[model samples]
Target: MKAQSTAHRVSRTLLFHVFTAACGLLMVYPILWLAGSSLKGPSEIWRKVYSLFPEHPTLENYINGWKGFGGVSFTVYYRNSLVYTVLATAFTIVSSAVVAFGFARIRFKGKNFLFACMLVTMMIPPQILIIPQYIVFSKLGWVNTYLPLIVPRLFGQAFFIFMFVQFMRGIPLELDEAAQIDGCSRGRIFWSVHLPLMKPALFTGSIFSFYWTWNDFFAPLIYLNNPKRYTLSVALRSFSDPSGLTDWGAIFAMSFLSLIPVIVLFIAFQRFLVQGIATTGLKG
Candidate 1:
């Protein structure tokens, strides 16, 4: 009876793993198809639409895609995206941390009301503010520039601020008290103690901020008028002509290339992101 029961458990575990593997493959099939399509010859793509493997792989798509339109290569667009994303992410991290630290640790009048107001902002859709933002930026002559993309991040982003606040609250107050006892000013305590302990949360925020800014299409589409100023997302869109000529091969190639940075960033920081999110509301 013991041996029979053990065999039954083993069979159940095997079936469970088999089922999970099948589900994972189904979920990942689209991405795998995309990757495969990027390597296929344009003529073969539609013909072999159902096939997971490419029949005739070539580098021509990548080469042509990199050449780009209007005398601008993808290199320029990639550089612009990197600069825009990095600066925006940096500003978001610093600004969010500051605001969150204030709300989490500092005591002041009207703090709760202010924090509540900020929380309310999180519930509001960004689309509602786009018109007002556009008008304001246009009046300031900041349209068609990276300013429209980067400057808004300098102000505290409500979601990031809330995320940091939750993580900061998980940290013990004893550290702050000990720092104070050692003659550390609030700023010094924040800089020397809180910042170091907040690495996991900071990394989590950085990953999110980088991903959002890099993938942002609407803002860049609205603000940037010049082809030279286009980011990867916008440039990728230009490959499709509404007149019915679309370079599916080149689009697939560039789209695959555009995914590299995001994939690398996520892989490198996924550990910290998971840790930060898992521990967010837990007391240390």
Candidate 2:
């Protein structure tokens, strides 16, 4: 019986490792392929497609991709994306955390009802609201500008608010009482006491906001009419040419480059990020 149990455990461990390795390879292959393709010349990309290593590697694609075809520079698009993403993400974190704190801590009439309504709003598809939002922004002459991207985040987002609220609920009310007894005001209690405790949740929210805003294509596409206002996602679209001059190598290089910021953000906050997600589910 002991021998059988040991054999069963070993078999399970082996199976788990096999599954993990397979999944890791599957996730990594596309990134590897893109990196290899980015180094290849246009002719080498199409002609020697099956080869994992480029026969003749070159950095010309990166140079050209950054510069432009005729008058469409990717550097401008990258700058626009960085600006919009940073501001929008910062606004989202602050607004969402404040709103979440109120929902979780403050006593108010219709608080439960309002929270219910907010949850229902989360269930509703964002696509349905885009048309109305576009109409309003257009009427206000905000199209072709960054306002459309940044302004909406100031009002507080539902998902981040929900995540923050859940995390705040997991923290004990005793902390608030202790702060209050020490003559701390509500603002100070939140800023000095609760805010430090919320580091994990804040890191998680900021990372999500950064990634989503950085990679958002639809919002930029609808609001930005000018090539100069394009985000990386939107800029990638410009690479598709019907004139047979589209540089797939450069497109792949820039696409991979676009992913680096999100990766760095994740790696930097990996510790807090893991804890945040775990604790979010600990409360109602």
Candidate 3:
């Protein structure tokens, strides 16, 4: 009876692992298909739509995709994307941290009210604000420039601020008092005491900011007009002609390349991302 029970438990564990592996493959199959299709010849891509392995794999798609349109290589678009994504992410981290610090640690008249108002902003859809934002940027002569993309991030993003605020509140108030006793000013306490402990949250926010800014197509589409100023997302779209002559192989090749940064960023900061989400408002 003991041997029979032990065998039964082993069988169940093996079944569970097999089921999990099957589910994981199901989710990852599309990405595998995309990678395979990117290497496929143009004709084979459509002809063998469901094929995971290409009959004729070639480097031509990547070579042609890198050549880009109108004598401009994809190098320029990649540079534009990096510049905007990095600067916007940096500004978002700094501004959101500052705003969150205020809301989390400071005590003053109307503080709660102000924080509540900021929370309300998060409820509003970004799509609704696009037209108004475009109008304002147009009036300011900021169209066709990175300013429209980078500048708004400096003002503070509500979602990041809220996340930071929650994380900050989880920290012990005793740290602030200890810093005060050591003759440290509020700013110094924030800089020296709180900031170090907030690294996980900051890293989490940075990952998100990087992904959103890097992948965002709609805002860049509205603000940027010159093909020279286009980011990777916009440039990728240009590869698809509305007249049904889309370069399927080139699109897939560029799409695969475009995913590299996001994938790298996630892998690098994955530890902090998990910790940040799990520990928010739970520490102390």
Candidate 4:
């Protein structure tokens, strides 16, 4: 009976692993395909559409893609992307944390009403705000500049605010009290006491902000017209021309390269992401 039970448990575990492996492969196949296609010769890209790996595996695509169009190379676009991504991400997370800390810990008049208003902003579609925002930026002479992309994030993002507030509430109030007894002000308590403990949520928010800002195409497209100022997302779109030929291999190569930062970030900080979501909004 013991022998039979051991055999059954081993078989069940093996079956489970096989099922999960299959699901993981299905999800990862597109990325695998993109990597494979990026190595193929331009002609071979379309000729062998279903091939998993390139026959020749030439680096020609990477070479051409790096050269970019105009006088500007892809490195310039990468720099632009990095600037926008890093600045916007920092602003978003910091602002969200500060705003969330206030909403969670501070009690003042009209707080509930203000919280409700912030919640309502999240439900409004971003497309609705685009025209009005564009006009305002244009009037300020901020169009075709990085200011439009970077400045708006100085204000806290609604989604991150809510997430941080929920995460903050889960922290013990005892810490705040202890810090107060030690002659720490609210700012000091937040900085020295709570900030370190809020690592999981902060890391999670930073990762999210990085991903969203790095991949954002719509805002960059609307605000930026200069080729030199274009981000990777916007610059990649320029590779296609309806009136002429498009370089599929270069597109694939750059596209895959652009995904690298996001992938690396997730792999590095995914533990925090999981922990942040898991522990948020529950009292000890």
Candidate 5:
């Protein structure tokens, strides 16, 4: 009976692993297909729709995609994207951490009310704000500029602010008390005591901010008028020909290239993300 029961457990575990592996592969098949398609010749792309391997794999697609349009290359698009993403991510991280610290540690009049309002903003869809925001930015002569993309991030992102608040709450209040006993002012405490200890949460916020800003399309498209100022996301869209002359191979190649940075960043810092989220949720 003991041997039979052991065998039964082994069989179940094997089945579980097999099932999960199959499901994971299923989910990843599309990405695999895209990567495969990117290497195919333009004529062979549609010809071998179901095949994940190219009969004549070539780097020609990447070469063509990098050449870009209107005398601009993908290099310029990458630079524009990097600048926009890095600046926006930095602003979000700084603003969210500072605002979250106020909500988590400090006591101020109307603090609860203000925090509640920020929470409400999270519930509001960004699409609803676009029209009004465009109008405001237009009136301020901020249209067709990076200012429209980067300036708003200077204010706290409600989602990141909330995440930081939860994570900050997980830190023991004794740290603040101890810092005070050592003659540390509030600003000094934030700089020396809190900021260093908040690495996990900060890293998590940064990864998220980087991904969102890097992949953002709508805002850049709406604000940036000049082709020279276009980010990777916008540039990718410009690669499309509405008259049915689109370069599928080149498009797929660039799209695959765009995913690389995001994948690398996630793989490098995913541990911190998991830890921060787990600790924050438990503590909050």
Candidate 6:
């Protein structure tokens, strides 16, 4: 019986490995292909279309892509993206946490109703409001500025608020009560107890915000007019040739570079992100 059980386990393991390998290849093949294409020379790119590997690999594409021709450099666009992403993420974490705490812990009139309204807001498609938001920003003369990108974050985003509230609800109310019994105020309880316990949720929220703002194209294209103010997403559009030829190699290289920040962020906060989501929504 034991021998038969061991054989069954081995068969399952082998099957799992095969399934995992197939999935990994499906996901990684495109990235590998893009990287392979980026190393190929112009002649190799055109002539060796059927080949999976490049005939001649060179760094010339990366050099030209980084320095650019005229106007703004890739470095400048990267800096712009970094700045917007960091600021927006920071504001989102802080504002969303505060609002979530109010909804979860503090008792105010119509609190449940208001929280329900906030949740409903998250269900609404953002595409529906783009026209109204654009008109509002234009009316305020903020169309050509970063204000449109950064200002809304300070008002507490709906999705982040919901995430925070859900996480906060899982924390024991006894902790807040205990703090109150010790002469601590509501603000102190939140700052000292809830906030520290919510590191994972905060990290997750911030990472999501960073990715969203960094990859955003439409907002930046509509609000930013100057070449210097362009993010990496917008700057990539300029890589197209005058005669309609696209520099696929340069685009892939720049895209690979753009992914570095997000990769670093994930590596740094991965532990916190996992812990936060796991602990959150455990019990009221």
Against the hidden reference, what TM-scores do the models get?
Answer: 0.93, 0.88, 0.92, 0.91, 0.92, 0.87
Q: Report the C-alpha lDDT of model 1 over 109-132, residue by residue, as the tens digit.
A: 999999999989978987999999
Candidate 5: segments with Cα more than 4 A from true spot = 275-284
Runs in model 1 deviating more than 4 A are 242-244, 275-284
Q: In candidate 4, residue 165 scores what lDDT?
A: 89
lDDT string, candidate 5, 1-284, tens digits: 99999999999999999999999999989989989999999889999798899999999999999998889999999999999999999999999999898999999999999999998997898899999999999999998789989989988898899998887888999999999999999888888988999887788889878988999999999999888999999988888757757888999999899888987887888787677557656321
In candidate 2, what are the lDDT values of residues 1-284, reduced to their tens digit?
A: 99999999999999999999999988888877888888888789999776668988998778877875448787887788899988998999999988998999999999999999998897898799999999999999999988988998999999889998888898999999998999999889889988899987787788877878888998888888788777888877776555657677778788777888877887787776667557665221
Per-residue lDDT value at 198 in model 4: 87
C-alpha lDDT (0 to 100) for residue 194 of candidate 6: 96
**Candidate 6 local distance difference test against the native:** 0.82
Each prediction's whole-model lDDT (CA): 0.88, 0.84, 0.88, 0.89, 0.89, 0.82
Worst 10 residues of 4 by lDDT: 275-284
Ten contiguous residues minimizing lDDT sum, candidate 1: 275-284
* CA deviation > 4 Å runs, candidate 4: 1-12, 276-284
Q: Enumerate clash totals for all models, in the order shown.
A: 0, 0, 0, 0, 0, 0
The 10-residue segment of model 6 with minimum total lDDT is 275-284
| TM-score, structure 2 vs. true | 0.88
lDDT of 3 by residue, 1-284 (tens): 99999999999999999999999999989988888999998779899898889998898899988988888889999999999999999999999998898899989899989999998997898889999989999999999999989888899998889999988998999999998999999899889988899987888888878888899999999999898999999988886656656688988888888988987877777887677657654221
Report the lDDT tens digits of candidate 6 across residue range 264-283: 77788777656645654321
Tens-digit lDDT track of model 4 for 1-284: 99999999999999999999999998999999999999999789999897879999999999998988888899999999999999999999999999999999889899999999998998899899999999999999999999988888999998899988888898999999998999999999889977898887888888878888999999999999999999999998886555557688988999899999988988887887667557654211
Q: Global CA lDDT of candidate 3, please?
A: 0.88
User: For model 1, what is the C-alpha lDDT against the true structure?
Assistant: 0.88
Stretches > 4 Å off in candidate 3: 276-284
